[model samples]
Target: MQTLVQTFMERRGDLLTALWQHLGISMASLVIAMMLAIPLAIWAARRPKWAEGLLQLTSVLQTIPSLALLGLLIPLVGIGTVPAVIALVIYALLPIFQNTYLGISEIDASIEEAADAFGMSRMRKLFKVELPIAMPQIISGIRTALVLIIGTATLAALIGAGGLGTFIMLGIDRNNTPLLLIGAISSALLAILLSALVRWFQTAKPKRALTVFGVILVLLAGGGAYSAYANRVETVTIAGKLGSEPEILINMYKDLIEANDSHVKVTLKPNFGKTTFLFSALQHDQIDIYPEFTGSVLETLVKGTNPKGMTAKQTYALAKQRLAKQEQMTLLKPMKYNNTYALAVTKQFKQQHHLKTIGDLTRIEGVLKPGMTLEFIDRNDGMKGLKKAYHLNTTAKSMEPALRYQAINDGRVNLVDAYSTDSELRQYNLALLTDNQHFFPTYQGAPLMKADFAKRHPQIVRALNRLAGQISETDMQEMNYDVNVKKQSAATVAHRYLVQHGLLKGAK
Candidate 1:
């Protein structure tokens, strides 16, 4: 409990920023949905056949899983607030549109006859009679949408759209209970508060209610303007995959770029998403650069890339060549470390089973239920290749990276597939079994950028390239440990490393 409060206090600034972002996204989505759905519902109510199909369509859309919808949107819109808001609008549409249609449709025929007898025009009748009677139902739909939008807005973080979900995702990745609770609790509270505000709006005098809503709209507009102005500088945005290592590496990149280029401001979009998400952002020019692994460059980015017979240098050559030729992206000089895939087990489990190599796992394959990542379980260089190469038979069980560690620690699983340089290996004192067959590709880390960006900013390229052979395996692992286990900030750890190595001028 003390740790939870301390974590909340320490990260209060970030929490508030996330809260503002969440509010902005949720409210914008709700307002947009209201504007679109309410008008459409009114028009459709006059045409029952069209109304039935359109309302049904929204129901179908609401059925699409939030994560799946975000994934689909990434390829089209790229990742950010735009796609997040669009998704929320889709989900919000169902409730608002359906309720409004039903509300206006359910009004008594006598009410319409009275309006007609009084010589009310179509517009006046709707404003004075039909809509006023339906106002309560409309308010209910809006309230429901506001709450739904608030909950679903959390997913925006998956695509680099910042919100409270950032804290939740980071907490899960780092296995921090406090961070998880903070995001979860904050979101619940926000939803309750907003729901109550909607109820108040329903009861308040029209003038007063409109005044408060106007203030909110003005504040939102101001925030948007401020964001645009802040981004007007010469900014070089660097994004990374989800992990402490990627976060630390990007911090290193930001420090190097800012140290060398004064006119260029560095912006680090750490833990933006997984490899595919970042790569899509790079291709769409949404981000300026991101650090990528050589193995990943060939594995998923390009087609027909075989690194089977290639050494680390040979593999990098293939990846760098293909990336430049096919995608017009520059793969910079890689770091010296090899963060390739490997399987691990607790020291006691390893000793008891006498495990030494990939083939050795076959001894306990039947009883083994190893917790692995979904990516590793599906990849050719991961589980598929491991099984074919080593002839190891075991049930395939996929899990999140962080949860894998927790499972092993809790004795739920005895083995796990892991990156060779993962900090958790040292943290948990796990033993990495040897890959005698050497099936995994070399995974040297390097900075990747669009060719156009490189051409436009040669100084940034040169600055990032200076890290080519600077960071060794030990240097990276220690840095990871610092951020993951020691609770040190990635920026601080990166700066210390840079200063100590004379990459930047600073007191160590």
Candidate 2:
């Protein structure tokens, strides 16, 4: 308990920011749902057949997985708060709509007759008699929907939408129980408090309740507008892929840019999504820049033909040239590390099997079960390349980068693909097998952006390139270890590295 309290205190600011984001997003989504559902529900109550179809539609929406829905929204609307709210509103609509419809349609016919006998008009009866009588059920539905929204709002962070889910996902990625518990427990508490508030609205005077809701809407709008205006100097959205390394790198980009240029504001979208998602976002101008890899550029993004025997420098040069000519993208100077993919096994497993090379996995063919990431499993320089070059193949279960470590640690799998600079390798005491056949290409991390954006923002490019050949293999591994194992903030880790390395002057 004391340790948890200490952790909470240390991360109080971050926790509060995430909680506020979560609450605002959830509340905004619920309000939007209420607006859409109330009218639709009234129409449905009038036409029973249409109401049934509307119910079926919302039920189908409920059946769609939240992550899948977000994925679908990305291509249409891109990411961030927009898609997050849309998904949540869709989920919230069903409950609120159903409840509203049931409350109105199922009202006692005796009341309707009484209202008609009193000469109460249709609209008057709806606002006065029927609504007052059905208020309980409507409020109950709102409470249910609010709880659902609060719980699910955590996933919003996965798409660069800030929320408590940021802590949860970061925790899972770094294997930190403190972060996971903080996010989960906070979310549960938020749901309870908000549900209580909704219940209170059931008893409050209509004018008072409406006033409070109006105030909330105003606050949300005012806050968003103010934030936008404050950050209007020169907004540059910088995104990165999953993992502590990318998060750290993006923070470095943010810190260095802000330190170098006062007018430039760098907005970091850390853990934005997959490599392809960020690349697409860059192409579409949804984001300004991101940290990409030379190998991924060569194999995954460009879809270039097979290239072998290329050194790290050669890879960087080719990636820069091809990105400029083929894709009209800019690949900035890479860092000193080669964070290429490698296969790893536990020290015990390596010793037991005498595995020194990737080919050694063939010795345990049927016995070897490898845990890898989906991108790695499918990429040409990953599983495909391994099989083509090493003549080794196994039934590999694709999992997140973090879970692979957990699987190997728990003995569920004997093998896992890993980045060269992954701190988990140090934490887990795993042995990286030699890629004697040189299957994986050099993965030099660099700042990637549209060539036009690069040309326009030469200062931004220069600020980012301050890191060129600066961070070495050991430095990156330790930084990852700090954030992933030592439980440090990416911003702090990044800022400290920059200051110490003379890449950044004053902390922003």
Candidate lDDT (C-alpha), each: 0.90, 0.89
Give one digit per residue, the lDDT tens place, for model 2 in 283-387.
768789999999989887884675698999999998888888888999999998999899999999999989899878887898888899987889878897688
Q: What is the C-alpha RMSD of each candidate to the true structure, in Å?
A: 1.5, 2.3
lDDT of model 2, residue 106: 97
Which of the numbered candidates is closest to the native, going by highest lDDT? 1
Model 1 lowest lDDT segment of ten: 303-312
Q: List the residue pairs that clash in candidate 1.
A: none
lDDT of 1 by residue, 1-508 (tens): 9999999999999999999999999999999999999999999988999999998899999999998999899889998889999999999999999999999999998988999999999999989998889889998999899989999998888788889999898888888889899999999999999999999998999999999999999998999899899989768889888889999889889888888977778887777988899999898878889999999989889877494768889988999999999999999999899999999999999889888997898878777878999989888889988899999878667898999998998999988999988889999999999999888899999999988888988888889888888888788889888988888888899889988988889753
TM-score for candidate 2: 0.93
TM-score of each: 0.97, 0.93
Q: List the residue pairs that clash in candidate 2.
A: none
Q: lDDT score, residue 189, model 1? A: 96
Q: How many clashing pairs does model 2 include?
A: 0
Instruction: Give the distance in Å from residue 427's predicted Cα in candidate 1 to where it truly belongs.
Output: 1.6
